[model samples]
Target: MATKRNVSSTKEEGPVIDEAIERNWEIPDFTIKEIRDAIPAHCFRRDTFRSFTYVFHDVAIILALGYAATYIDHLPSAPLRLALWSFYWIAQGVVGTGVWVIGHECGHQAFSPSKAINNGVGMVLHSLLLVPYHSWRFSHSRHHKATGHMTKDQVFVPHTRKALGLPAREVDPEGDGPHSALEESPIAMLYNMVMMFVFGWPLYLFTNVTGQDYPGWASHFNPYCDIFDSNQVSEVYQSVAGLLATIGLLTYCGQVFGSLAMIKFYVIPYLFVNFWLVLITYLQHTDPTLPHYRENVWNFQRGAALTIDRSYGFILDYFHHHISDTHVAHHFFSTMPHYHAEEATVHIKKALGKHYKFDPTPIPQALIKSWKTCRFVEDEGDVVFFKN
Candidate 1:
């Protein structure tokens, strides 16, 4: 819990996001207490009216998409039907999931002024999509609060080299490790493109593959009630409702589109959603150059600031409400609504200047690059690369 870090840099590694101390500057104790503890003023300048409008509009779109799926799907001709199917599946899956992230903001209570509103909105949308709203909210907030405190961090803790004859690496993906296997994937290379996009979220919460450990009281799998536990009744009930809704959707599609057409409708677009979701989450973090801290040296500011941002296209950007674009701001001020995120981010960058990290590469290329570069490399024994 060191509070102060030397802000000077003379090394030539080209602005990587490592939490390690650099050699040229003296590494000071960088506790959270030292890092401009004031929440930025920009955080308060939320255009709540506009954000509410956007949220309202996004909710409309979700209903509209579902309506489209349910009724007046497409023209009956084979080619025309195929075209409509292609448009909806591809558009809805990738783009639809983007709105879901906003719903995720609701879970974070970052979308609105009221916790009831946030939870209500999050509950509806997330439960509709099979996400256990309260479960994710509680867990995700823990991730933010304890971002890099090794002893108390929720997810993504780096494993030390000496621990398993490896440098500080990502913690184990299997049982008894940092997070569950479903949370992070060994196959993260094409993760968003296919593997995780389709199966990642399902496996993680349901199976607890790479998820955080809880005492028996908090298990997500159990349907029993417990306050302050992530795996609890609300999660179970909401998850059941979401899953049942999905089944109902499939059943409806089977009746209308026929078994084969329903299969096409259900699977294809869903693939796009999973792919993009996985990809977005992946590139936002998970760089080999980014260092994870150990118990003594970890700090939240350093951990949250270690994110990398890249530009996605305009169409996707509008659909997702720049959540991808505004994630840096989100990390810094988790309570800011999505609409205000862009404005807040602009100000934050101005203040941060070079302290900010950005990756100018396009998403496709970065995905390819990260695939090759970011595979399970552990922490280094020597702290020189991470020197202060």
Candidate 2:
């Protein structure tokens, strides 16, 4: 045997080059081909059968949970029954939201290779959830295409105080003494969170609450809305029809089960679904590390790289199909099936090295931190990062 050497004397070098390169926001020398080469060829292939298996699996659990809630509602013990029912709603809501993620995959053409199958399933699932599928699909596509573009991004376009006709001094308050008017008071924060979780998604869809500001009133469901062009009118109308059908279905359910029963079973869980949707998207895009770029500095690769990967715990990861964790890869290859996204993400992390942003912070803490820190950007630069 050879004598043992003191290898500990020679230390590993830090990733200094990678760290410096990550901060270089101009453009990257590394091409997309390098990333593609890192991933296995099989990861690019979509298997419709396997995709449907997940859809069916999530649907079965959702139905079982719904039935369980009904049984729990009939239980005699008031406090125990209420506790069980609350747990059931939370469970069903999360599982149902996972189903919505699959529908989103369909909209991205990742559910299957067949566009017809993708559209058909997406329309059904999203419509039942009160999302106009075609309308959301088109707008979400635009978001992906222009992810980091400040002025062009369709959703969560943060504006300067001046743009909103508020004084800059109001946003950047005098000293560290008191919070700015834009800062939410503790009670107000709680109320805002409740309202956001309950009605944010529907309001955003119908009224463009946090979406891009258009010259006139803009609504996602309006076929002639500036978000869509003339060619998209038919698809928008189809989406409208689907939403109308879902409303009619809700009406029938209310009539049969009574309003309170309907609210208990369907409405509350629906709200939770919207909450998950908005929360996931919000956290994915809005982070202090990510910079929003103007047209002069924006490009597809840089825009796509702005997304962050988050950990949502293993059990929830399985339930949510790893959407939170594998979001970076999803942005890069939007048509790649969710089953393959994790593997793809591993390869991307390898390729991106220090440039890949993964935040392991617990979601609640992360959410609060982002809400406090990521208010708005300045009006003067080609690149803008969040402030206060």
Candidate 3:
């Protein structure tokens, strides 16, 4: 069992830690049943028609955008054409991510009560987005089951102090050990952010970057990868088949439409979809105020509470289906559909009280802040917060 240190004694004995970092990081006393009870029963009901409506709504916008792009080249002014194409990329990327979110809902069986319907829709949508649907769905289930568990959570698992080569607590009790010069440099940070937004998703899918370490190969594409069970190998292969089919389709489209047209119509906006996916997930789980627990201190209720809710403003929130704003509720009740998440969130806040974390910082500022501050956690604590 992991042991907890007295917070007051630690402050007095070592160098002063930031007061803001000194939060109530103890394990929550509440039960998961209590949280479930807090939410209204109706919020748990799934509406298949309403779910399909959103899927249709997003697909219609994407089709309209594609149709609008056909006229961009005919515009008399080059500058106007360029500006509109850029607008189309950004707009389509945003809506594309909303489609991705719906697929995610389907993976969680929140889109409908019928598992087959959910999987069928989720498989097609995610496969179109180049995601291996069943592979990600299975691994993502593990992520939720063990969110904020230091050794167990699947993605965005923070590096430990020792893993990063930071000095031991006894050697640098103040935790003032300097980070590598390159890591602290602003230019390096910018470069890293660009690389992350552009390539992070592919790297994660191919190499399991930012995910838990496993023996031998660990990839979303590998049916035998450690992230899945023996029984799930067939499903993993199905995901792979779906991904291959999508790739074949895209290859055909690129040849038929010409590569530049394909790039303009698909690739650039697809990159933006990757950008939004990384940004939203990174900010949701990575914050200095959030705590990750060692096995002895970890529980589903506590892990779920560690998630942070942030507003991406009204417009983005609507398009993205409130994924950013109501994440805490989603973590607690993964089966709850997005349309009803906001209603459930109100009750979740009351149930969790001080334990529920919400950050109101504008997303751009919050992204920078988390990237700079949430580097790694201490090696020894039962409950540890990220340290710069």
Candidate 4:
């Protein structure tokens, strides 16, 4: 493992920014291989049976919740049924989202060593959730490759003042502008929560809504979209086929069980899964304390380090499969399975020391903070930090 040198000087030479984020700006003394070496070898190995166990476990809970929700649908009181249904959807939906995470692991080749098993399982699982697996996998690889690069990063790239057509000094440096007001407003929080959790995922995939722009428009579903090159077109077509097959299955379900039944049992939970997916990714990357680098300053270690580790409490962590809390490690080592992320993250944190970011800001507060303050990046720096 190659070790970095002159870390103290390197730390000082980096662009000056928010002291909070600048503290982590210095290149660490340890290298990626050293960080990997700290983790037990077993942590890097994929366990196919164990990975499948997690999938089956989440699916079992989803089925149980669905059955229970159906039984509660018979309740005499409308309010009781409504409350129970709401709880079931959130619970089952979150669990189903974990299923999606498992498939995502398959995409990263963290689920197993066999590419055939990974693609087969990921395609089936993501397709069931109305996601195009190969399409996402290809684009997501781009994201991991260039995580904090202001221009090259694929998703959740903060808009610049120019991009938003605002003047350079329009946003107050003192943090008391309209953005601050929005941050403190309950209505704004509610509005942001609604948009982020409800429509954020599909809009992102369909239109590249929060993503960085290519030469033209980009959509994950289009095989010919710039998101993929000609070499990768066939795989994207396979992804489209998976999506079409899922649509056919859902249509068949609607015909057999009635549209309302389909909505009650599947659609609501599907939306919830999307909500969780969007919320997780958004919060992971968007933070005032994180920096976005232009090409000249961006490096893989810095880009990967830009991710924040969030706590969703114990039960939510289980439902999310710890993706929220262990995301920093995942970014650093994309193929590390969720089951091993905690261990790897612990080692990385110790190795990285002050550079490791673990934000204890409650998720709701963090969401509001980012929505308000992380609106855009500095207009003219090689290393730009977020501002309102």
Q: Which prediction has more favorable lDDT, 1 or 4?
A: 4
lDDT on C-alpha atoms for all candidate structures: 0.58, 0.81, 0.89, 0.82
Prediction 1 global C-alpha lDDT: 0.58
TM-score of each: 0.72, 0.89, 0.94, 0.91
Q: What's model 4's TM-score?
A: 0.91
- Could you give candidate 4's per-residue lDDT for residues 1-388 as a string of tens digits? 2123222123345543432244455544456787777778877889889999998899889888877777886789999989998998888788998999999999999999999999999999999998889999999999999999887889998888678766556354644245456555788678877987898898888888888776566898777878888999999889889999999999999999899999999999899889889888989999987778766466788788888999899999987899999998998898888999888888888877887999999988888778777777656555667877
- Tens digits of per-residue lDDT for model 1, 1-388: 2222323222332322233443232323343333334345556543546656766776676557656865434556777766766766776675567667867888777766777777777777776565677766766787776654444555443433344443233443331233333434546434554655577656656654334444454444456523235445555566567667767877887987699765555566666766676678767766555544444444567656666666787788778777687777788678777666677677666655665667878877776666554434233221212110
RMSD (Cα, Å) of model 3: 3.9
Task: Give me the candidate number with maximum TM-score.
Answer: 3
Poorly placed runs, candidate 3 (over 4 Å):
1-22
lDDT of 2: 0.81
Better of 2 and 4 by TM-score: 4
Which whole-number lDDT from 0 to 100 does residue 108 have in model 4? 95
Residue 337 lDDT (model 3): 98
Q: What would the per-residue lDDT of candidate 3 be over residues 146-214, giving only the tens digit for each residue?
A: 999989999999998788877876576556444666776889989999999999999999899999989
Kindly indicate the candidate among 3 and 4 with the higher TM-score.
Answer: 3
Instruction: For residues 27-104, write the lDDT of model 2, one tens digit per residue.
Output: 444666777888999998988899999989999998888887878767789999989978977888889889899999
